[model samples]
Target: MAHFSYRGRSAAGKEVKGEIEANNLDLAVEALMRQGVIPLKVSAKKQASGLNVDVSSLLNRPIALEPLVIFCRQMYSLTKAGVPLLRAIRGLSQSTTHKLLAQTLDKVHYDLTNGRNFSSALRSHPRVFSELFVSMIAVGESTGRLEEALLQLANYFEQEMETRRRIKSAMRYPIFVLSAIFIALVVLNLKVIPQFSSMFSKFGMDLPLPTKILIGMSNFFVNYWYWMIASMIAFALGMRMWIGTTTGRERWDLWRLKVPIVGDIVNRAQLSRFSRSFSLMLKAGVPLNQSIQLSAEALGNRFLENRLIGMKTAIEAGSSMTVTASNSGVFTPLVQQMIAVGEETGQIDELLLEVADFYDREVDYDLKTLTARIEPILLAIVAGMVLLLALGIFLPMWDMLDIARGA
Candidate 1:
């Protein structure tokens, strides 16, 4: 069947726009007329371009989480008020201020009007709606609880935004300090060290080892700055290419979870995501196997995703949740116990939510104390750099002073 897009007037003289599938233009208009819409303009919908890379899509930025949260909340309110799905989408499309979201909603509205389900319509826009989001909607639609699903999604995204905001805020000071250190190092290499080297050369005296090292480093920096920049760019591009590979990406993700100071937070954050997503999916009436699969994919850790996929495999083979979780080796002992108890009581969803809460609290505390934890290490690094600079710049002067006094 061919798809046609149409703009028309409803029975109440309200403007409407949508797509309809039919064998021909005449049939499309006939179908619309059957739905009480007078087709003012009807034409064949443009098929997707055959190009592998869509320039327009490339230029369009992905919608942000805040807008999604707003969209979900609005959908929940509207759906709860008994508004028809298509009309709700159409209204939202018209009312939304975000250009991308409005455009996306317009497409979703068209699909809904064309007799497509909301979840399936959303699935078509993967750049706008995630798998988890679409799955939630599907579950909602199936279970007749779409409003509740939207509410849950809104809450989930709100929490996620808060966590991300806190992390960024906590990291800001460290990032600034590090940037300052880098600038200082550059200034010393380019300006301060060079001047010192020229002055030392005029003395016609032997320099100490530290001074010699400093002069040599300064000379290299001054002479080979372009090479350094080239190497940095090349290394960055190389790393990007390596990380693009499945194996390299997996290994790097695993290494991220083992890094000092940062790893613990990353682990807890990922666990929190998995637990919350798993709980959400299960509570929404999704099947256990599907819930595990979706939650694992949402974790953003390849190592954990692979491990939980194994857990899914084990469970599919008739292993218990607790047994599979324990065998996965990613969950903590406490979490394993909770899963076991949850399994026994048939309250696994609630238990997983509690696990998420526990991890969220842990992450919050760590984020708050993150600067305190990192301060000592940063100070030590700065202190060592300062000491080196002091010694490198001053040691030669001390020797020159002794030589002059002796002469």
Candidate 2:
């Protein structure tokens, strides 16, 4: 299908503009007219040339989670209020601040006008909507509970955003401090140490071991700087390529969950995501196996995702939820007990929600204490670097001063 950008007048002769996808421009104009819009100008949407396109945008132009959460909340309100789906989408398209999302919604409205189902229209914009989002919408449409599904989605996305915010906050100070240390080391190696090395060479005396090591390091950095940069770039590219593979990704994710304090935070956050997503899907009337699969996708940890996928296989083969969860080794004993009780009581949704809440509280506590735990470690590192620099540079000067004073 081809997309057309059009300008027209509404039934009240008010100016209107939007995009529509059709087989051809003629069909697009007809579609507009069917909406009671008089088309004054209609043309196929132009694709930008490769040279004019921003390559960086392709890599990082993600729809922000908060905007998506807001969209879900607004759609839920509109759907619940009995607003026609097309009109609701049009309103959203007009009011949204995110340009890409607004454009996608405009297209969705046009598709809905042309007899496309909501989920199918959403599927056409895979970059803006995920498989889980489309799947939930499809389930909602089939069950005639789109409003509830959207509301659940809004809450899920809000929690996801909060978790991300906490993780970023936890890492921010350490990243800043480490970056500062890196910059300091680079300046000392390339500029400061070399100046000191030149002065020390004129003394023509045997230097201390620390001073000799520092001088050698500075000389290597100055003489082989290009080689060092190339090596760093190559190592980065190699690591990226390795992590792109299935085995490497799984190994890396497993390693991440074994890290000191950060690992616990990541583990709790992933479990929280899985529980909440599973609860939302079950509440939306999705089947258990499908909900489990979708929940696994939400975890964002390959290790946990694989384990959950295994649990889905086992559960589908007549194993109980508790048994499968225990075998997965990703869930805690508390989580397994809750799932068992939930299964027995047939209130799995509520129980899963409770699990999610429990993890959410744990994650919040971890975030609050994260900096306190990390501060001492960072201080020790800073002290070590300072001691090394002082011993390496100052110790030699002390010896030279002794020689000059004939001691």
Candidate 3:
């Protein structure tokens, strides 16, 4: 099959031209005619603008959650307003500004024109649409409640973006402080210490231990600066490669939860994601086992995902959900109790939503206080650096003062 650009007149005798995919020119022309276009020309479609291509964007650009949220919101409004699905999709395809999403929607629109369902067309764009997204849309299509599903997805993605925003904002001050500390250290090691060491050498005096140690560090920095940069780059690359592996990822995920002050927040955030996804899927009529699997995988924590997967296996093997959840050790005690109550009442979906909200609130509170919590640590670090500089650079100067008095 190939793409063909065709120029023709519509049924209303208005000029219409567009690209279509078909086996050959004749088939492309035939398809155009069937759409009520009196085909006058048909030829192979070529890239319209070679200069518009960007290697960086092609390699690094990813469809962000914001676009997906907006897409769902738009689709929800259009569908709720009683627009025809194909027309709505085609309009969205033309209107969207994001190049990749627009192109993907164009293909989806073409698929819909070819008698494929919306979910099936979406399933083909796995990079832009996750498995959870496709599954929810499939359920919506099957149950004739597409708008609700779209709304739910919009809310989910919006919350995700919000959480990310909060994390970045909370981290800004700490990042700045750390950068300043690094710069200060570099200056002291390269310039301040060397100047002091040269002056001390001219005196032909025996330097104190702190002064000697500082001089040695300065010499290393001047001679081995390139080595330091190369080591940093190599370490970063090595870590990236290691984290890309399954076992390495699992270990990293588990280790993150052991980090002080931040681990609890990360754990709760992932649990919130899992509960929210599971709730959304269940509310959309997805089976419990399937929801568990998908939600667990979406958490972005391999260790927790494995534990949740075990819960699924247990459920499949006739164990009660509450029992499996309690045994999983991934959830908090309060959350486990909620699950038990939700099971007893047969309102797991609603209860899971509450669990998600609870976690969100906890995460929000923790983020708000993150700067307050981190400031003390940063202050301690700066104080320690100041003490070291005083001892290393100033202690020897006092000894030299005594020698000058003796002379």
Instruction: Give the per-residue lDDT digits (tens) of candidate 2, residues 346-381.
Output: 999999999999999999999999889999998999
Model 2 weakest lDDT span, ten residues long: 51-60
lDDT of 3 by residue, 1-407 (tens): 88888765575434577899999654675588588875545666766777656464457465899889989999999999999999899988899898889988998898788887888677656568877898899899999999999999999999889888887888799999999999988999998889988898998888777778788988999999999999999999999999999899999999998888888888988899899999999999999987987788778799998899889889988999999999998888999999999999999999999999999999999999998999999999999888877887787788889888999
lDDT scores in order: 0.87, 0.86, 0.87
Where does candidate 1 have its weakest 10-residue lDDT segment? Answer: 49-58
List runs of model 1 lying over 4 Å from the truth.
1-53
Error of 2 at 318 (Å): 0.6
Q: Which regions of candidate 2 are displaced past 4 Å?
A: 1-60
Any idea what lDDT model 3 has? 0.87
Give me the runs in candidate 3 sitting further than 4 Å from their true place: 1-60
> Which residue pairs in candidate 1 collide?
none
lDDT of 1 by residue, 82-135 (tens): 998888899989998988889889988877788878886776565688778988
